[model samples]
Target: MTGTEPLEGAAPAVGAPLLEATGITKRYGRYTALDAVDLRIEAGRTVSVVGESGSGKSTLARVIIGLERPDSGSVRFRGEPVRGRRARRAFRHSVGMVFQDPYESIDPRLTIGEVVAEPLRAHGLYRRDGAARVRELLDSVGMEGVDPDAYPHRFSGGQRQRVCIARAVATDPELVICDEPTSALDVSVQAQILNLLLDLQRRRGLSYLFITHDLEVVRRISDEVDVLLRGTVVERGTAEQVTSRPQHEYTRRLLGAVPAISPRQRRIGAPLISDAPAVPDSKESTESKESKESNSA
Candidate 1:
């Protein structure tokens, strides 16, 4: 089968979600990392989960990817339970992950070619033309003409992230879970990586479970958004709805925190600093102090 086609028996049934989690809960000792969260992704679209740090965004990604099994609830891929060894192995082949830190995600010991080919080799997809396939994947992510034999450390942060993205799509998976994929890059580089993701999604017909703390990113990449706060989803709606007219207090706070490109571009009624006090002038302070003293007299 070609890269564009879904894997055999991996396609979802009609009207079924590509991936779904219901009432997911995870705990470590007495602390709950995830509290009864429900999320779903549709085919060929992006679903983003947005929250602050420690809000269970990564935990949800882990649970959905089977890195950590939830204490309660279930995850389904293609409308079937992701349980048992065989089922999980199959599920993994159809899902790829781009982790937050590029520096740590790739092995320093391996060459770029080997890093990208690891998934293909693991899934038994690497064959006679595997090297060429690896090169093709690298080029797709704008890494053309670089020697694949070079170690990951030789590349810049943005370059390494491009490599990570190449590896994520090497297997031509149906879904890619991006955990803060561009958070570590510089502002300009972040735009490039996000555009690459959008391009890949269009070309490969891939779905995304995009997890980020940045609401601006949600505006750019997501079709639907789920606002996660302290392990629970406080709001869910279309990307525009959640970002532009957020109803939940937590979601509004998150949007308010995003730095606008210019003061004029900031949302109407959304201040540059939310609930922040203005710097007091020395003259104004003295005048107010004198006024207070005279009033007391």
Candidate 2:
């Protein structure tokens, strides 16, 4: 389809996958980053790709999002090939991405409002009420009181990620490709961000292609899971099926690597450490006072 034509006007046929990649292969000289990889994501669902570093998870995301082209195979969005500059541009309006490092993803020089409004402006979706839209986006992502004029450096990592998320969804894209979006956040903050993403998906009917090495995260957010090892998918199934009943040897090993505390080892309802030292017993205090008096006498 041409760029001038509203790509969103042409909807996918009923029952067709939202996005499909078939036999995608990528080579960097002799090194193969992806080997005949195939993936499909449905509407309003999460499909997680789990793998360690250099296992082609990021490569797959990039290829599907048109950041990097595969050597072979094809990426089809809404049943149309994402080919040529115009087509890729059209495809981008329907998709968005959130990167692994929130700090690195945003430009420090730009104000938060500018960063969030960028996608809207780029795709010609921004209007006279764009600033108001920016405020609404920030509020939706849990940055309600944040100053829009503030720069990226002023925000915490988690807060910056929220801004990135706001930017990603500014265009109201059908799918968001999150490439390790929570990997760099604190454990507690990770849970909050995950929840926010889930909430956004439910409210907006957005789909996610979540990429992460953490199987724990997959279990938490994924509807389907694909295990990638050495640039090849070793297993693919529902999140429950792959996590609880993994058939692949590599998948099992990956699951085993996740640290877990046994019920016996967990310290439930433990008190937080206090800054003040423990008080001495009455007997010890009396003895100390008596000793001091005797020495003075």
Candidate 3:
């Protein structure tokens, strides 16, 4: 539980686990989106969760940010159980998010500055210095050209995403859960957004629970990764270890699906391929799949 134990369920970490979820179980009617999943995130590190479309990565993110509650299990923030309204509010303020579609995420009616400033206003973080702070934040994310009053529809997808990033960081959250944040952008734009996220993490010591099916992205942004298949974590390890030296069959299959690119980095500026195949049904215990469907219905 303390300072970067990195290993699992060993103790009450000294430095504290910024976010931890134990035996999290979620059922949508009959289908179980998550099954007894345990996760630990440390401050100032990026942890990628690699999975197919239906592997429950989105479900996990929703539960983490309190958008969805698990039927069973618990989520802890800084080692404190998060269940009450106050705790959920605290989670909202401390855990920011950037969704997949920038255009959909940003309001076309609002200016870039307005969009970024909304989080502060909603969280009551606005003060006498709010205006100045907004510009600084905008500039930091490279959307300085955007007039604080210029509407979101005037900007390109990449610029809009930058606005989203600025807004998510407005509360100065300790952790950012980016759910396919750049999936809608062009290749060059994706690189810019990805780099922006990395730079912010370095400058602010932010932790990230990045969800994506893109293995190359996992290597680029994560210090470590957890591969999920059929709603369960199948493999967990450092980026180099997980990406370069996969230990599980599922993990190997995921990596094998990655397109050939320069080993040094992803082939950015190329179109992104977020539409990867789901885990094989036969691989899942028939009981587990049937059990989840019962929950889903």
Best by lDDT: 1
Q: Where does model 1 exceed 4 Å of error?
A: 1-14, 260-297
Regions more than 4 Å wrong, model 3? 1-15, 260-297
Instruction: Write candidate 2's Cα lDDT for 31-110 as tens digits.
Output: 88888888888999899999889989999999999888899999999889999999999999999899998878999989
**Local accuracy by lDDT, each model:** 0.81, 0.80, 0.77
Ten contiguous residues minimizing lDDT sum, candidate 1: 1-10
Better of 1 and 2 by lDDT: 1
**1-297 in candidate 1: lDDT tens per residue?**
011111111212245689989989999987888888888898998999999999899999999999998999999998899999999999999999999988889999999999999999999999999999999998888777779899976676767788899999998999999999988765545666787788889899999999999998898688888888778887888888888888777888999898653455355543322221111123244234334423332
Q: What is the model-wide C-alpha lDDT for candidate 3?
A: 0.77
Q: Candidate 1, overall lDDT? A: 0.81
lDDT of 3 by residue, 1-297 (tens): 111113221223235689999988898877878888888898888889889899899899999898898999999998899989998988889988999988688878787777888989988878889999899898778765457988876566666677788899999999999998876665435665787888889899999999999897888778878888878887787888888877777778888997654433354544232321111123233224333423332
- Residue 22 of model 2: what lDDT? 93
